[model samples]
Target: MSDTTSTTADRKLTEGTALPTQPCSVVWSDGRAFVLEPPVWVGLDHRGRLARLTPAALQRQGWSHDKLS
Candidate 1:
């Protein structure tokens, strides 16, 4: 028989540790989705939060406030 009890230290995942690369999928805009594969760097921003960047965010710094012709 093997020991089943595990501690927090044993379950912890090291930050920035290199693991087997795999393609990861994400959904956005209700049904729109995409996949990011290996060799792509994945890290958190200064704010330390993960969020999907919307189409409006790609145009300019503040497309929402910018006047459209």
Candidate 2:
């Protein structure tokens, strides 16, 4: 049982450390939706408008942690 628990814990840690490489979806506070593609981090709005935001812009908008798989 102890070995099983250790294995489970290790598996959880490995899974938690992995970052997603695919495009993630995010929704702003004003009901606007966007899809953030990685590598370039370009945002595509709900209306199909493309907007490229820098890290500072993203931080200012407070969308640094709302990525959905």
Candidate 3:
């Protein structure tokens, strides 16, 4: 999904080794708020910028990153 400029609550949610809840707060490397569902992945790109990516996209590109890092 293309990134949007909108937002979510500032309330931080608890995270675990596993995927947390659906509709959890996922932010960009710049701290830009990005709300996405679980089964998602997060990682830094070649530029070292934090990226919010879906597992499908990551797999398609053969890129590996922390599931929620």
Candidate 4:
């Protein structure tokens, strides 16, 4: 099988590039809402700042992946 792993360089090139928008939301324990773009897993804060949701943070924050169709 061909190597399907993407290198850091490849990721860097695509990082911060806008893909097609698929807007969704996740909530904090305090009920703060964040707008997320799934498949990308990055989001925007209430003030409209970009938020990077790391795996560790997601688990710690009790986030579930709920895709909005």
Q: Which candidate is the best by lDDT?
A: 2
Q: What is the per-residue lDDT of model 4 for residues 1-69, given as tens digits with 9 covering 90 to 100? A: 111222233333334543324567553311233445564346555466767765345434433232211
Let me know the TM-score candidate 4 reaches against the reference structure: 0.33
For 1-69, candidate 3 gives per-residue lDDT tens digits of 221211111112212222224566544422333345566655566566766677445333332112223
Worst 10 residues of 1 by lDDT: 58-67
The better-scoring model by lDDT among 1 and 2 is: 2
Better of 2 and 4 by lDDT: 2
Off by over 4 Å in 1: 1-12, 15-18, 25-36, 48-69
What TM-score does prediction 2 earn?
0.35
Off by over 4 Å in 2: 1-40, 67-69
Angstrom error of the Cα, residue 9, model 3: value is: 40
Cα deviation of 45, candidate 2, in Å = 3.2
lDDT for predicted candidate 3 compared with the true structure: 0.38
Give the TM-score of each candidate.
0.21, 0.35, 0.34, 0.33
Each model's lDDT: 0.28, 0.43, 0.38, 0.41
Error of 1 at 10 (Å): 11
